[model samples]
Target: MEATKSADVVVVCAGLVEMAEVEGVDRDTLSLTPGHDELIKRVAAAHKKVAVVLSNGAPVSMPWLADVSAVLEGYLGGQAGAGGLADLLTGKVTPSGKLAETFPLSLEDTSAKPYPGGPLVVEYRESLYVGYRYYDTAKIDVLFPFGYGLSYTKFEYRDLSLKQTGDKVTVSFKVKNSGAVAGKEIAQVYVRDVESTWFRPEKELKGFAKVDLQPGEEKEVSVELGTRAFAYYDTGSKDWVVEAGEFEILVGASSQDIRLKASHKLAGQGIVSAADKAKLASYYNVTPTTEFTLSAFEALLGRPVPANIQPGKGQFTMNTPLSDMTDSFMGRQMNKVMQNEIAKMIKGREDTPTGLTMRTMAKEMPLRSIAMGGGSLNLSKLKAILLMINGHTFQGIKALLGKK
Candidate 1:
């Protein structure tokens, strides 16, 4: 390895400082600096095989992506890294990392609108056209798209299938590692409306699955599309109106690489009537789901109930809160079940009380315990009240919590 400034993941890897210069600048409006071009050339010459790793907080014009033999993103891989990079580089670890942002061929294919902070207060002028949503909607070609990544080993994606089970839609496929080396593969699922009444993206990522495969081994990727996944945030309707229509499902390595695809019409029908859309729009600027925070609580309880459920005609109760039906026996039982599950999660947080005690015994705790005080107390409480029923102040608990 060369003597260079290390970033979170092999930081400042000979060329990062040059790349960082255009961080906040608009890719389309901006041009590459001469110094950056020189730095790129110099870095390419430093290594035996020039593999460009594109990592940034947001998208950048990768006119240079095709120029390099390979590109990997270490997007926001903070602090402790390099070991992972070294492993992937030396073939010790296969590059299983997938992209978190879309890389545009040029900034033009990107969202046409720029951030609103130009000589005025910053505002979101682009509205919904963010990330791949913008590029796909505008039909702009991207350099590299969201969910795009490559591995040393080659994988073949095949056998696309779609089926409707009640309101749920299932898209299943097979991915085989045809290359010599064992590796990991990500199966990407994208959905596009065939007869959308309003303007929509060409395709949107519905789901993704990651799997490990030995050389020549094949694995199945099954993605289920719920009502929510297919629905778009209708600004006018003020709801996620799943308008009745045919939709195309695309499965592939990246957005552009469509290995297999299929189309199906939605079962039953959900019509967002003009009256409903108008009434909803008057109450709020857009549909309720647009501003609602998706809750993990739905997944927390054994049953699926909205943590932060969205408001719509049939999606949820109109006047009654989903969690407020506890007066009824079924509702009370559900509440109890949710409470028990939440308790389990809280208790799980204190799993290593004995380890904290050991650290305290060694008196090696750092001084920033103030930041961690409550956590240590919770652990101690769990060990005493829940684990042993011996509610004594465990030594080193204070130190572990930054109290020392």
Candidate 2:
């Protein structure tokens, strides 16, 4: 409050912590550290010239984005990060890097719906439609799209052309540094099947090239697209297929920022074996926005998802999650007793976030994790627990007694 009135510019820093972004654990929200958003809101409210610097590894929801002047995504930039940031902020070096992934408006907007699908099981429901593919196809608004970047200079795109001769394809365009500065611009080329028999992304990145330009300098750039660039794998034929269609070539700075485009009609046909067609037809038509159902996924797996099936006695195996180990009376009792033991271990901190997380993990953990974590489970004890869940309670108790 005291500094805002006197300060010329306010620089607020925000990002995710190690706990929020780790290998095994999944973040509940894309929001930057809980209070960082509010802190930025306050700072932006205090001053009009507010800039934000982000240091997180992944996408973070930024509700206060419009309120701030500038945002620098300084993502986990190693040891010399501070010095490089200084160069960028002071204009000693023009920032020319582009975003590798899309930043969604919220965690819910991401393609991976119901994220952290499981501790023991994970399903790639989105399949091929991930990142920009999902956002562009679904027409969902994003915070920042993939390949998005802003530099010291502005660039213009013109004279885009596309040529296709059977298996060979070429895309050419011109990019000019319209702004009064020298900078490098990355030209991205994406291919779209204007019409297709199977569900596919609106456009796929085929090729890209970086060009250095001076003020008013325009350079022609060409990117070649091979057969693989415009093809999708057909399980029926067990090969890549380029179905007869009109393919659109799009050139842009980012996935959303299309500057130029041209279309070329391709004459190609694919053969689908009847057997594979029967097996794959049901699962092959899932569009970018469509929900990947259990039935569809099962069709792909050629069987029912084991996780979806209710675990019964003789079914609660080592791979089964602890949450599913409650079918029989004996199984329920054993699960209850083990849960009580976990509760006692985390009793004092039960109300805390860490404790809650631990509890959730314990519930989600597979029986194998107990053996690995030394959580009072050895091979013999595990065998006994399996026996208890699998309806041999008397035998399981006998094994427990004889276990060294």
Candidate 3:
């Protein structure tokens, strides 16, 4: 292959294999070893620029950081990894790689909790906070925190704007790739709520955008902020509540390395209670949900009972005792007619049993007549239909007719 032949030197970043020196070494002077240093040493001895292409299946322990000139974390590279690495090695493709997983200085400093030996009842003692949140909040040091990635070229971020438009907030910024090589940069957006009782990380990653740039090219990126993003999970209320206060929007390369930062407040109605029925009531119109329920049935008339309803059970009858003909006409007649038609349709079919259809029959049936009648069913009409259906006297048929 021309790729392998053209490269002056090839350094593969085969990640950390053995954390401890197995049976050969004792416990006292046990020092963890990095995996990439040997490859770097080999390539450096041969006098090459050194593409330390890091490839790993899972997170590896990078004990040594300063040895390698360039580091690329290639975890579980897909079908294109081999060829992609070859191109990057030969300088055919600019290395747009970055650290996917944070490289901790030591295993002890890592936020990774010790796994239980056996599969007993293991609890997530870490609670809601994990990864960089754990390290950032606990003040623990990490080799590289979350959202840490690298590009072939260097980038500079400037002009961060966090402005409120009505209820929502918009964040915008400019990124210019300053390095000579072309690369793809990821602009990470994080939010920090200063005043909150709940346990929270120093900052939380909210949104991200991947940007590609030619050498020295710059572009502006904008992101919109929704209310849910800025709020905290309140244990007392059992909901995400945005407390009335100032929230900071941090734009950066990683969770810890913030490049540009700005703050904004949630204006308008202030803090809305999760249990506030009045707030929820504001979302609906003058017509109650009963109107929507009725509209669904109104549209179902003359259509197929839609396989959802049972043939005989698709009717609605008067709920109360009917005092006069007017009550019977509206309540009983409407229910009986619809049921009679559905029953006929069910009897016509042989293979599909009527029993399975009965459970959901009423719900699935075309209840347009009842839905259009514009009010709740009276009690009399309900009893009459139940009595007829229970009595096994097809007299419930009258309820569906004589209305319109």
Candidate 4:
């Protein structure tokens, strides 16, 4: 706060370093670091010209968004990213990037909650309600919607039309730069089954096109959609089914920001034998099931879901991550040693993003992965550790000797 009070511009670089990031695991939360969030809020409060440049691999929440002047989501920029950011910030080029994933207001607003809950099993009970599919369908307010991006210029959508040639669709629209500067716009195309009274997403992103325009420049953009765009996979029959119905075509800047819409009746031979409407809970409903029930989910899974459980004493395996193994005595000892090792790896720069991530990975990483990731911890040593963790220390010692 003291540093930014006298500064003209405060640029806060924050967000996930590189997602739950690769083979490590899912992130526990969609939040910025406590220190980063505090700095952003305080800095933005002091200086209105706060430009937050987020360099992350996954979507993160921005609670202090309204307090800041500008935000640039620079997700996982590579070697030339610094030069690119300079060009964008210095007005050498116009920003034309769109968010591929929705940024929830908080972790609770997301479809996938209780994330990374257990070591053994995770239930994706939200079914098809994934990403924008869930947010758009549930009408949940988000910090940023999918396919959302802002430019130095404004854009207008006009002459929206859809041409249906048999089962395929070609959606056409005209985009004009309504603002003074030249800019690029992403026109996202979404398809909704207006006649579908089933467990379908309210709308699904089918296709999209990038439109570049000069001031007052207008260009026609078209997106092609095949049968797959209008069909859903039938689990029972193990095939895609496109039932004859009325479909709505939507073109917009994001899933929630629909600019132009048109409806078309798709002519089909009706539902095939593959579509078992009885099991779908669709034949009796007039709208997509918004509130998903456990029974319904279990019915969809074709089996009962096992109760979510956590790893504990006598259950520790080489596959258990250092983080999950805290329930056991030997596991806690192992975690302490690993933390000391990681502390040495980062040394003085323990607070940096790379350092924080390295430390985080060490905790989340499975005991067996040390061998798999080509470290000194081999399979024999891993077996010994597992045996000791499960309360067979003498046996573990014998096993280690046998391996040697």
Say which candidate scores most in TM-score.
4
* Candidates sorted by lDDT, best first: 2, 4, 1, 3
Cα distance off (Å), candidate 4, residue 381: 3.5
Task: State the lDDT at 299 in candidate 1.
Answer: 20
Stretches of candidate 3 off by over 4 Å are 1-10, 16-50, 97-100, 114-118, 267-404
Per-residue lDDT tens digits for candidate 1, residues 36-147, read 4455555555543456554445655544444445656665566656667767767898888777777777654445433324221233434455787766655666777777
| Candidate 4 backbone overlaps, count | 0
lDDT of 4 by residue, 1-71 (tens): 77877787878888655424655655667777557788888888788799999887888888888899999
Clashes of each: 9, 0, 18, 0
What's the TM for model 4? 0.82
Which digits, one per residue and each the tens of the lDDT, describe model 2 over residues 137-186? 88889999999999999999999987766678889899999998888999
Instruction: Please list all clashing residue pairs in model 2, or write none if there are none.
Output: none
Please identify which of the two predictions, 1 or 3, would achieve the higher TM-score against the true structure: 1
- Tens-digit per-residue lDDT, 55-160, candidate 3: 5454545443454556666665778888877786667877554455555556665433343211113333344345676667666677777888765579999999
Which stretches of model 2 miss by more than 4 angstroms?
A: 78-80, 107-127, 163-166, 214-218, 271-307, 326-353, 374-385, 388-404
